[model samples]
Target chain A: AQSVAQPEDQVNVAEGNPLTVKCTYSVSGNPYLFWYVQYPNRGLQFLLKYITGDNLVKGSYGFEAEFNKSQTSFHLKKPSALVSDSALYFCAVRAFSITGGGNKLTFGTGTQLKVEL
Target chain B: GAGVSQSPSNKVTEKGKDVELRCDPISGHTALYWYRQSLGQGLEFLIYFQGNSAPDKSGLPSDRFSAERTGGSVSTLTIQRTQQEDSAVYLCASSSSAGTYYEQYFGPGTRLTVT
Candidate 1:
C-alpha cells in the first residue's frame, strides 16, 4: 500500500512572500509523486510530478516541488505567492503495483492555501 | 482537444434508489479510473479499467458500487440502494495507458446527493 500526508489543513501567506506546502509519503517501492490544485467547484489540476532526476521539479502556475529521497517528502514551493494562488492543494503518490490504472493514486486530505494581499 | 467529461453534473436521489453516473474519457485513452470525494475529504479510489484487462475493484467500498466501460471509451458507475453516506462527488480520470508514470487527466466530476 502507498499513501501521502499533507500535515497542514490550511496555510496562510502574505502576497509576494514565499510559500510552502509540506507533503510526506510511505511506499514500499519506488514512488511517483504528484501535486494538484483545485479551484472552487473545479476538478483537480495537475501541478507537477517527481518521477526521477533532479530533486527540484518545476510545475504550472509558478509552483515547484523538491523531492527528497532521504526525507521521503515532496514539498511544494513558490518563490513569490500571489493572491490568485489561494486554492486547495493535494499531494498524491503511487508505487509500482501490477493491479491497474498506473497503481491508483493515493491522495492526502488536502491543504487550503490562503494568500492575502 | 477536449478533456475528460462526465454527465449529469448534479444529481439528487432518495434512499433505496439506484443511480448511474457516466464518464467519457479523451479519445484513444486506454485507462480510466473512478474516485470518490466527500465534503472536505481526499479522493478515495473506487475502480480502474485498463484496456481489456480485468478491472481492479479492490478500492470499491462496497458491493453496491459497480462500474463498466464499453468500447474502451465511455464508462458508467452505478450505486445501488443509495444512502446519505453515499453522497459525494464521483470523479473520472483517464490516461493514455496503464503504464507507470503517466499523467491522468480528470473530469469535472458528478455531484451526487442522497437523501
Candidate 2:
C-alpha cells in the first residue's frame, strides 16, 4: 500500500516571502511523487513531479519542490510568494512498478496555503 | 488540444437517488482516473482505466461506487443509492501511459450534493 502525509493544515505566508508545504510518503519499492494546486471553483492543476535523477524539480507558476529520499519527504517551495498563489495544495504518491500495474495514486489530506499581501 | 472534461458541473440529488457522472479524457490518452474530493477527506482515488486492460477498483470505498471507460476514450462514474456522506466533488483525469509520461491532467470536476 502507498500513502502520503501533509503535516500542515494551513500555512500562512506574506507576499514576497518564501513558503514551504511539507509532504512525506510511505510505499513499497520506489515512489512517484506529485504536487497539485486547486483554486476556487477550479480543478486541480499539476504543479510538478519527482520521477528520477534530480532532487530539485521546478514546476509551473514559479513553484518548485525538493525530494529528499532519506527523509521520505517531498516539500513544495516557492522563493517568493504572491497573494494569487493562495490555494489548496495536495501531495500524491504512486508506487513504482516495472510492469505498470499500479495506476492509482494515494493522496495526502492536503494543505491550504494562504498568501497575504 | 483539449484537456480532460467532465459533465454536470453541479448536481443535487435526494438520498437514495442514483447519479451518473461523465468524463472525456484527452484524445489519445490511454490512462484515465476517477477521484473524489470532500471537505472531510481531502482527495481519494476511486478507480482507474488503462487502455484495454481491466480497471483497478481497489481504491473504491464501497460497492455502491462503480465506473466504466468505454472504447478507451470516454468514461462514466455511477453512484447507486447515494447517501448524504457521498456528497463531494468527483474529479476525472487522464494521462499518457506510454513511455515515461505519468502526469495526469484533470478536469473541472462535478460537485455532487446529496441531501
Candidate 3:
C-alpha cells in the first residue's frame, strides 16, 4: 500500500521568512510524490512532483521540495514566505507498478500553512 | 472550457435527500477523478475514471455513492439518502491520461452541505 504522512497539522511563519512543511511516505515500490495547495473555496493546485531526478525539485509560486530517500520524506519549502501563500498543503504518493491494482494516489491529512505579515 | 468545471458550487440539502453533482473535464482529458474533502477526513479519493473504463472503485465509502463518466468528458456523482456525514467539498480533477508523468488539474469543487 502507498501512504503519505504530514506530521504537522498547521504551520505558522512570518512573511519574507523561509518556511517548511513536512511530508513523508511509505510505498511498496518507487514512489511518485506530489505537492498540492488549496485555498479557501478553491480546488487543490499542483505545486510540484518528484519522479526520479535531482533530490531538490522546484515548483510554482516560489515553492520547492526536497526528496530524501533515506528519510522517506518529501518536505515542501519556500525561500521566502508570502502572506498570500497561506493555504492548505497536501502531500500524495503513488507506486510505480499497478500490477496489484490501478494507479491510485494516497494523500496525507494535509497541513495548514499560515503566512503572517 | 479552459479548466475543469463542476456544477452547483454550493448545495444545501436536507438529510435523506438525494443529490447529484456534475463535472465537466478538460476538453481532451482522458482521465477524471472525484474526491471529497471533509473537516475530519481531510481529502479522500472517491472514484476515478480513465477514458471509458474505471479500474478502481475501492475508495468509495459506501454503496449509496455512485458515479459515472460518459463520452470521457462529463461525469456525474450521485448520492442516495444523503447523510449529515456526507456534507463536504466534492472536488473533480482531470488529467491527460492515467500516467505517472501527467499532472491532474482540479475544479473549483462543489460544496455539499447536508443540513
Candidate 4:
C-alpha cells in the first residue's frame, strides 16, 4: 500500500516571499512523486514530478519540488510567491505494482496556499 | 490538443438514487482513472482502466460503486442507492502509459451532492 501526507491544511505567504508545501510518502518500491495545483472550481493541473532524476525538478508556473529520498519527502517550492499562486495543492505517489495494476495515484489530503499581497 | 473532460459538472440527487458520471480521456490515451474527493476523505482512487479493461478495481469503496469504459475512449462511473456519504467531487484523469514519466492529466470533476 502506498500513501501520501500533507501535514498542513493551509499555508499563507506574503507576495514575493518564498513558499513551501510539505509532502511525505511511504511506498514499497521506488516512489514516483508528483505535484498538482487546483484553482477554484477547476481541475487539477500537473505541476512537476520526480521519477528518477535530479533531486530538484522544475515545473509549470515557476514551481519546483525537491525529492529527498532519505527524508521520504517531496516538498513543493517557489522562489517568489505571487498572489495568483494561491490555490489548492496536492501531492501524489505512484509505485511499481507487480500485479500489473494500472498506475493509480495515491494522493494527499491537499494543502491550501494563500498568497497575500 | 484538448485535455481530459468530464460531463455534468455538478449533480444533485436524493439518497437511494443512482447517478452516473462520465469521462472522456485524451485522444489515443490508453489509460483512464476515476477518483473521488470529499471533505472527509481527500482524494481517493476508484478504479483504473487500460484499453477498456479494468485491471484495478481495488480502490472502489463498495459493491454499489461500479464503472465501465467502452471504445477505449469514454468511461462512466455509476453509484447505486447513493448515500449522503457518497456525495463528493468525482474526478477523472488519463495518461498515455508511455515513456518513463507517466503523468495523468485531470478533468474538472463532477461535484455530486446527495440529499
Residue A83 of candidate 1: its Cα lDDT?
99
Using all chains and alpha carbons, the TM-scores for the candidates as numbered come to 0.97, 0.96, 0.96, 0.96
What docking grade does candidate 2 earn? Answer: medium
TM-score of model 4 vs. true structure = 0.96
Against the native complex, each candidate's DockQ, computed on alpha carbons, is: 0.71, 0.64, 0.71, 0.67
When summed lDDT is taken over every stretch of 10 residues in candidate 1 chain B, the lowest stretch is B97-106
**Residue B61 lDDT (model 3):** 97
Global CA lDDT of candidate 3, please? Answer: 0.91
Residue lDDT tens for model 4, B6-109: 99999999999999999999999998889999985789999888774544789899999999988888999999999999988999999997232599999999
Per-residue alpha-carbon lDDT of candidate 1 for residues B1-115, written as tens digits (9 for 90 to 100): 9999998899999999999999999999999999999988789999999999899998899999999999988999999999999999999999998777887889999999999
| C-alpha lDDT of residue A93 in model 4 | 92
TM-score of the second chain, each candidate in turn, equals 0.98, 0.95, 0.95, 0.94
lDDT of 3 at B72: 74
Docking class of predicted structure 4: medium
Write the residue-wise lDDT of candidate 1 on A1-117 in tens digits: 688999999999999999999999999878999999989888888999999899999999889999999999999999999999999999999897665434789999999999999
DockQ, computed on Cα atoms, for candidate 1: 0.71
lDDT values for all models:
0.93, 0.92, 0.91, 0.91
Candidate 3 C-alpha error for residue B16, in Å: 1.4
Question: Model 2: DockQ against the native?
Answer: 0.64
True contacts kept of each: 0.63, 0.63, 0.59, 0.74
